[model samples]
Structure formats: C-alpha cells, structure tokens
Target chain A: MQGATVATYDFIFNGLGLREWCGESVRSGPMTMADLLARGAAPAEPQTGFDWGALWSLPFPSLDELHKACAEIPRSRDLTRSLEAGFLNVRESLRFVLDPMTQPLSWALENALHVAVNTPWWLMLMALLVVVWLAGRSAALVGLVAAVMGFLLFVDHYVFAMQTLSIIFVCAFLCVVMGVPVGIAMSRSNRFQRLMIPVLDMLQTLPTFVYLIPLIFLFSVTEPKLYGIAIILYAIVPVIRLTDLGIRLVDKEVIEAAEAFGMTRHQKLIRVQIPLALPNIMAGVNQTIMMSLAMVVIASLVSAPGLGVLVLRGIRNLELGVGLMAGLGIVLLAVILDRVTKAALARVNAAASVARH
Target chain B: MMDRQVSIAIRHLYKIFGANPVRALEHVRAGTGKDALMAQHRHVLGLRDINIDMRAGDITVVMGLSGSGKSTLIRHVNRLIEPTAGEILVNGENILEFGETRLRELRRKQMSMVFQHFALLPHRTVLDNIGLARSVRGERRADFERDALHWLARVGLGGQEGQYPHQLSGGMQQRVGIARALTSNAPIMLMDEAFSALDPLIRTDMQDLLLELQTELQKTIIFISHDLDEALKLADHLVILKDGSVVQQGEPQEILLKPNDPYIVDFISDINRARVLRVRSVMDRAPETIPQVAGTVDVDATLESVIALSGGDTALSYAVRNRDTTVGYLNMQSLVRALVPTQAPRHGNRKQEKAQPAASGPAA
Candidate 1:
C-alpha cells in the first residue's frame, strides 16, 4: 500500500508533470505516502511475493498487476476527470429540484423515527396492534403481529425494528401518492407512457446498493433524505407500473359506454378507471411496501438507524448471536407487514367483486 | 306529420377510415366502389354521402348487412366517430359545429344510445346503470332514482333494481339498457342493433314493447338493424344501405313494393309480406253500399289476420274499418296480387302455392 501511494503521487506530480498540465491538485495538505496509506485504511503488504503457506499464491493479491494495467490504460486525452466534474455539476443542479420534493419524506421519516424510539415499548406495541387490526379487521392477524412484535421486544430489538417500520411506512405512503398519478398520466397518453417506461426500467434494473451511492454523493449522510430518497427510488417502480397496467387493461367497451354517457375526463378516470383498477393498484401498494422494507435494511449503511444498524454492528464485531437475533427480528416484521397488507388487499378484492355482482 | 318536423338530419356524411381520410374522401366522391377504394389506397369507406331526415316522433330504421356502416352512420349522429366530412343537425342546430360542452350536453340530454351488447356497466346496479347519463350530468341519486325505477318497471324489470348487469340474462340486460336510455329522456334514441344480441323470442317481445312505448312517448328513434323483417316492422321510413351507400329510402311498404335497386329488391325477396303488410296498405277506397263482409277488419290489422277472417275465400270482400268508421274496402284479388312478390322470378307457380294456403286455412 505504501509503495502504491508513492507511485501514484510520483506519476501525477513528477513523472507525468500533471501539476503544469492541470494546475496544482485541490487537496489542502502536503500528504505523504505513509499519511495517504494510513488515511485510506489499506491492508498491510505481504513480506514475500510467493506465500507458499497459501494454496493459491500464483494469483498474486498485490497492486503490481493493477499498476501494470493502469500503465497500459491510455491517458493521452483522459475523460474521467472531466466526467467526474460533469457528474458533480449535475448532482448540484438536481439538488434544488430534489430537495423540495424530498423534504416531506425527510420530515415524515425523522418524526416517525423519533416517536418510535421515544415512545414506551408497551405503547408502541399496543398502537401497532390497533393499526393492524383496523386495516385487516381480523383477530388472527392482530395476534400474529402482537406475537412477532413481542418476540422482537424480548430480543431487545423493538426500538430498532420500530424505526425501520416507521421509515418503510413513510416511504411506501409517499410512493403510492406520487406513483399513482404518474401511472394515470401514462395510461392516458401512449407517448407519455413510452417516455416514462424506459426511465422506470432503468430505475428498477439498477442494483440496490448503487441506489445508495449516488444518493450518498447527492445528499449529506446526516440528512434524512439520503436514505429516504434511496428507499423511495428503489421501491416506487412497482406501484407506477401496476397502476399504468391496470388502467390500460380496463375494458374498451366500458370506456366507450362511459364516453357515450357524457362523462367528463376527470369523472371517467375517477368513477370508471380507478374503481376497476383497485385490485392491481392494491397489489402494487403491497409490492412497494415490501420493496421499501427490503431497501430500509440496505439503506442503514448510510446512517439509517434500525435493526439493520445492529446487523451492521454484529457484522463489524463478528457477533453471531446478535446478527442472528436482528435477522430474525427483520423476518418477523416482514411477515407481519406482508400478512396485514395481503389481508387488506383481499378485502378490497372482495368489495370489488361484490360490486361487480 | 312528423315528416315535416325533422328531428335529426344527416347530410352528405362521409366516413373514411384510414390515415389520410381526405384522399379517400376524394375517391368516394368520385363514385369509387368500396372494394376499389380499399384495394387502391388501403382505406375503408364507412359511409358515403348518406342523407336521412329522422322525423320527430317516428322510428327511422336503417337496415344493412355487416360492414355496410349502419352502426357507423348512427354513431355519426352523436359524433361518436368524427366524419371525414359532413353535417348532422339536431333540431335545426348543426351538431358538427358543437363544442365539447354542447356535444356532451347533446349526448347527455338529447341523444341516448342502446348498444347491441346492452353496454350496461358490469360494476353498477341496474338502477345505477339506468341513471348513468343522469349521474354524468351530475344529478344526485335521489333526483334520478325515481325516473330509473319508473323506466325499470316500464321495461318489466321492476323488482331487480339492486342487481348488477352480469346477474341478468342478455335480454333482461337489454331491457335495463332501454330503461337506461329512457331514463335520460333523451328525445332522439339511437339503437344500434339493440335487440340483435337477444334470442329471437325475446327480441320479438322487446320489439313489441318498443312499439308499445312508441305509441305513448313518441320519441324520435333512429334504429339500426341488419334484419330486413325487423326494419319493415319497425320503420315508418326505411333506408336500405349496401357497401356504405344508400341503395333506397322510403316508407317500408313502398320500399317493399317498388324496390328501385336490384340489391334492395333481393334484400326484401324472402320477407313474409302477409305478416308485415297491414290492411290499410292493401285496402282500396270503400265503395258505397258495401256488401256486409264475414268480418270488418281494422285498418291497422295485418294482411294475415284479414286472410284468416276471410276463411280462405279468395272471392270474399271485407270492409276495412278505422275504429267505427269504414275507411276502405279490401278484396281478396288485390290481396293476392300484393302477395305475389314483384321480385320473385317464377311468379305463376309461387303465387299458386301462396293462394292455396290463403284459400282454406286462415278463418277459425
């Protein structure tokens, strides 16, 4: 690691004369090879190039091969530096737009997380039971939620799990609120749909960890929006897609009949399209919620406090029992949320079918 | 009387379906045929220069086969399909020039359509379905429910208000459709193959009910049908269409008797004339000191009833009465001549068999 840092500075300032070509570097201090290596938290170098103690020493794990590869890489007209500047500029420009849009989400998440951690354990548990019972209208679902939450409490993960739930609830609600109208707009116009589908595809196909990286650069880690934005972007795809599909799949004759009856555009959308699209929309909401929960765990790496933070700590300290208990708590929370939402979806379908009959 | 008070008038209406309708409209105006237009330019000519004056308080039935654009023509009245070029006037006001608000008002308050598939919303109750137009007009449930219930009962669906469309049979659903159309009280009702989807028996019953309702309501009805018999029965004015152009148009009886186009002639060739031709159509001026007949047939009675009353006596003469007044006289000779269809090629043999049935069986 020491040799690599010395070579990097030597190539940049002396061997390449980069100081004369590109001006002095923006770095403030006169960083030495040892200081740079220490700051990077790099691994210690192997004393021997051939470690006969290891099974696969032929596959050298030093930067020698990487240095040779870098030498071969063309630097005649480098684009990487300019590209990085461009990306930063873009991120700066988008801040004005994204900050306002994401503020409500930040507020909801902070307040909910605060309340969840501050409230008494019994109070929060009772509140969760009431909410589950109201949504599902089922005693069994209530009992199941109570049991799962009770176990989390017993394992000393109750507040952490609650914080995760609070984030998920806020993210999922915002996703539905924002996604449904976008979907409706897509359903109304084919051109709009064509424009939006590619963007949605990119969002959904992006790796989950990649979602946090750009967000981390774009917003401060201390700001609630850093993780809030990541969770929303990761989870909003299903709701928008299903909503557009549901509205598009409405029967043509039904639409024609609506038009013939002199229904206005808004009336038709509300009374005919949305009512018929309830089942698909509800399913989308369920998927969005599950995706949000999944993202919440991953989002904790960027300062989000939850059971995921405990899991991260366990991993850092190599504590097997702590990791297992946190993982179990997350699983239980997942089941409770899934069952409650599924029950609500079933009720919606029942009401729709009854209306149809 | 309604002939003088035209309710809806379609003038020079042309509907050409394709990317470039103007180019196709030029071909249609140049007297291009349907097949030629399609083959040459990949355009479908839906209607060509259609001109029909739908009278107030009368049923004008437009009859044609599939792809003849009868449905297209009826829909054009409501501007459901924008015409390639033309004008539709409702009550002397051009509907083609109507803006969105006016168009919506026309659809909501002036014209209500009955679709062949009933078009009842599957998600709504029967009463709600009937009140759709009213509801779209922003009427409250209480304001329109009574009218819906009234029409529901009138269509013999009184006790089934709370039922959904899927729970009803095809015929019953159409009755709900009729109730829906009437509940709006739209003066011009456009029925596009309204009874075509029902069983024959239920269709006949619906036709009878429509005729019964027409007697009192006197709503101007523009009924589109592919059945010649249904057209002849229902239409006060019949328009025959073929390949998107009008082949003939007149009173149903006149069209049946003096079909100008061979296509019109062939279309009515298989019609059972005796069932459709009324006594007033066959009756002559009543002669003074008319002989007391076996029975006085009403002027509105069908020729089949007259044949039954005569008891197959071809020589018998009957007094045709309009209520208590003797309006005209019907002799079996004229009835026989009317029965000998002008379109049939072998007139002698066919007339002989028809006379044989007319001779012995009718009177009971």
Candidate 2:
C-alpha cells in the first residue's frame, strides 16, 4: 500500500471517460438533461482524440479496496438509499394516519385560499388595506401597500400574486402552529432537543427541491398536499429555532420567582414565560412568513398555481418581462408581509416592556 | 398580637447537594465533615442534621454567611428543595412525605415565602402578584382582590395595585412582596433575605415595619439573613449556622450574651453589642423578696437605654418587667457581662424561652 501509485491518468484524472467535450474546459458543472432545458441544446463536441497516451491506462491492483467497495455496493446507489426507503415506508403508512389529523389545516387553508382568490379584487384589496392599516397604525404604510397592489393589478399579476400570498399565509400559519409547540418541547426537555436538532438541521440544510422530490414520489403532484407539505417542511425551521431560543432565553430568576409563588408549571408558562418571550416568537414568525413566500415560488414547480408558475413559465420560455414582473410581484408581497409583521412585533415589544414595568 | 407557641419543627434535616446524594449520605452519616464530603466524595453538604423549632407568631431568624446553608434550610421548610434525609413538620405533620398536590396545598394555604429579589411576577399587576396564592388555590381574581387591596394599603402601596412590578422602586417592590405574602393569609411566613437586597437605611425601615406588623398580626415568621445586626434586631429565636451545621441557636439576646461556638464569638465581635443587648438577657430570676428597684425597666429595653438611664452607676439594680409584672431582676454588672461575649463555651445551661414562662402574660 506504500507504493500504491499507478499510471498518471489513474491517479489524478480518473473518472473522465473523455478528454474534454465542447467548452467543458475540465471544470466540472451541471451536465444533465436539465442543463439542456436552460440552454437550447447540448453543444456538439468537435474533438477527435489523438491524445490517448494517458487515457486508456487503468489501475487494477487493490483487492482489499475492491472488497470494501463491494461491501458498500447495496448502499451506494442514491447514497442514502436505505434512508430514502425508510422515509418512503413511513410516508406511505403514516400519510393516511396523518391526513386525518392534518385535515383541519388542509381544510382551513383550502377554504381561506378559495375565499381570497374568489372574492372580487376590489373587496380583497380593501380588506387587506384595512388589516394593514390596523396593524401598522400608519396610513402611509397602508397607502404604500395599496399603491403596490394597485400597480400589481394594473400589470394583471394581482390574482397570481394573491394566489402566491394565500399559499404563504397558510404555510406560515401552519408553521407557527406546529413549530411553537415543538420548540417549547425542545426547550423544556434536553432529550427532545437532541432528537429534534438533527431533523431541524436536515430541514434547514437539505436542498429545498429534495423536500418536494419525496412528496412528489409519495403523492401525486395533482394533490395540493404534496406541495403543502413541501412548503411547510421548507419554511418551518426559523420559527422552531427562534421559539426554542426565546423560551430558553427567559431569565432564570424570573422562573424561580414564579415557582416560589406556587404557580403550577402550566400557569408559570402561560402567565410569565410566554408573554416575556412574545417579541422573540413574533420575530420567528416574521422569518417563517418570509421563508414561506420563498418556498411558495419554488413549490410552483409541482402544480401549485401562483405567481411562481408564471416565474417558472417565463424561465421555460425565456420571457424576461414575464419573469421580472412576477418576481416584482413576489417582492411587493414580501415587503407588505415584512412591514406589517414587524410593526406588530414592535407593538408587542412595547406592551411587554410596559408589563415588565 | 398572639403569644407564640412552637409551630414548625425541622428535625434531623440533611441536605446533600450532588448526584447520588443518597449514596454519598452514608459517608456523611459516618462522621465525614463537609469538606471531606465535597473534596473526597464530590458532594456538597448543604445542611447537616439541622434541628430548629420555629414558634408561631415569632420571628425565628436563621443567620449564616453565604454557602452556610441558611437559604438551603429556609427553602427546605417550604419543600422547594427535597431533603436527602429529614423531617419538616408544619403544624406537627411531616411535609417530607407530602405528595405534590398536598405540598402545593401546603404552600398555597399554609405558608407563603418572600424572596430576596421580591419574586414579584413582572407580568402581573401589583394586585395580581399579591393574589397569587389565592389564584393558585383556584380563587377568582374578584374573590381575592379585596384582600389583596387591603394588604396593599397595609403595606402602604394602596393606589399602586394597577402598576406593574418594574414601575416600582426596589423598596416598593419588596413592600409588594410583603403584601403578597401577607395577603395570602397563610399562618406561617418564610422570608429568605427579604431585605438583604435593600439599601441599609431602607433595610432598617423595612425591619421596623415588619416588627410593627408582627406586633399586630403575629403570624409565624421564619426569616433567613446573613447580617448579624439584622438578625439581632428582628429575631425572637435566632438560629446561627456555619458550613451547614448549627453553631448556636436560642434567643438572639442570650446567644449574644454567651456565644457557644468560637465561630459565633468571631461573628458577633463586630456587632454593636450595646444596641442589641436587652435587660432580659442579663437578669436573674426575681428574688423571693422583690429587689428595691432603681426603677422599673422593661425586659425588652436595650442595655443602651439602661446605660443612659443609670449614667454608668455600677451599684444600681432594677426589676425587669415582662408586660406589667416582674419576672427577673437586672443589675448593672450583669448588663455589662451581657454586653460582652463570654470566652468559655457554656455547656447545657442555656434557656432563654423560660423568661415569659409559668405565667402567660395577660391573654391577647
């Protein structure tokens, strides 16, 4: 094993079947069929190789290495194939059980979206404007939102934007609903935190498209749930991390003080801890909503009708105006959501400080 | 105020703070010292075989330095910390065996504790924090608000009921803590360094106010303090601890006159002895022939007052009165002896609870 080096080609330049192709230049990149979708077609290779001096040589002197490789053969395909199979098994059996439990959320989101899209554009605009005005308590911010909505309407992207928005609102709502309790459980128990941290890490760092890929295989793209679950998994991380942090950050003295008063665990949590942690939780919700909007655009790849579909269509068809206009609509929605939530957060902070007083 | 009788008895209590304290306790029980337990066995001896009988309607102050387990002992009374081995009997029923529900019931209905930091719920208004015990017992806010308001007024924070804790100054915050405890109307009150967080002047005022309230309400109070001056002024029965063991405990005046431990001697060395010494500490039992008194001096009168009255006359003697009748006779020489801590450890002869004995002072 000490003098293990072999031919020059085998050591430094193995795994390349050809010397080079097109303008490849030996810099590895996306070379799949999807790359052809972005570009018109794969450029033809004009190279005829007379450079086979080092190309055909191969190393074949390692039985132990071959055995080690053979042992991993079953797990080699898909890299994490066993994990994939395990998750798929759970999804198949668990989906039916979960759908009943999660039906209310799906029902609520579906009804909400139905109302948001089916209502007259003017009435929807008025409702949103009123809500924004109430939250921000600033007529100027409301007017800015109205003007953005007005511009979106003139551009005829209002309905698509609204569709995108409704999806985000629902996903963000569900993220908070589920995330807060999980975060609380994490903060309350070290064992729960140890269990959740890796899963949360996967949810955060695993490719966003990978989340949709599994759902696509498990459920048809036609079912809203496929994208719904994908969006939730993609967007739920911030709220969970922040909510856990918020609870964990509460002053220890305050907790001891509460316990001393003979407040039961539930009473202490509700009456003391949560109110103090509200601002942090609100910030978490804000990040969740923003992330939800981001995922909504990506989710359109799987039959989720929204401004994201338009963005995808523009990408597919090379229509710059179409893509830019839809992207602009997403930006406007983001601004509105961000401002309203932030204003509400500031108000919560004020009230919290007052209570602290 | 009602005359105090024995209410809470903490007997053979041991608190060892460590994982596997039950196992480490064998070493502790087999004559291991606190240092040996910590350095050799990796266990902190929080309290060791502590015994104290807290009298009803009296301020039984427990004093110790930091890490002396004074706080630990006080917390044990409320069962905030489960003792490794011990008995805490509140009204003669062992609390060590209490289930969670019974313990909570004891906490909410029988005893209320005031904390060093006041322990006011920052989220609650003054009224709400004051009504916490009642609220814990499932009483509606309306049902307790009147009592809460009454205590608020009593503590001189009447109109501040609507205000939050942070709106008040530190002194005001502790007043609310007092009101919260008193409003609970629990028979026993435990105060752990309740005024230690206050400034010295505010501390004196707070102590005075506590004594004033105790005179009327006479609730059994178990107070924990590190300050010798505070203990001497406020304690009816003072228990001194060192390294989780009782060094000496009895009446503060008697303990001051005759410190049993060298540690206790060093502790009281810096105290203003004349200000703390009272006539009851120095006086002998009244002679069968009542003395020709210089004048009637209350048993509770500080030696400073006697010194001022007699103008350093060594020949004078006075009959020491408890309420209106003579129970003991005070001499100037005895007063001087009482002012100084004795060098020799007095063995098995200390009895200060006998002063107001045999005849109950005119019934309240």
Quick one: best DockQ, which candidate?
2
User: What are the per-residue Cα lDDT tens digits for candidate 2 across A1-357?
Assistant: 212222233322225433232122221332334334525644433447664643464334343222222222122333466787888879868778876766676676677779888999999999999999888788888988999999999999888988888888888988999999988888899899999999999999999998887777667667677778888998899899888888888876567656666778898788877887788899999999999998889989998878999999999999998999899899998998999999988877766644331
Alpha-carbon runs more than 4 Å astray in model 1: A1-77, A120-147, A150-156, A310-332, A353-357, B1-4, B269-271, B286-292, B340-342, B345-364
lDDT of 1 by residue, B47-144 (tens): 88889988899999999989889988988888878999988889999999999999998888998889888767766789898999999998999999
Please list the C-alpha lDDT of all candidates, in the order they appear. Answer: 0.83, 0.81
List model 1 lDDT by residue over A96-157, tens digit each.
88888888778888999999889998888899899988889999999999888888888778
State the local distance difference test value for candidate 2.
Answer: 0.81
- DockQ for candidate 1, C-alpha atoms: 0.27
Q: Using TM-score as the measure, which candidate wins?
A: 2
The TM-score between candidate 2 and the true structure equals 0.82
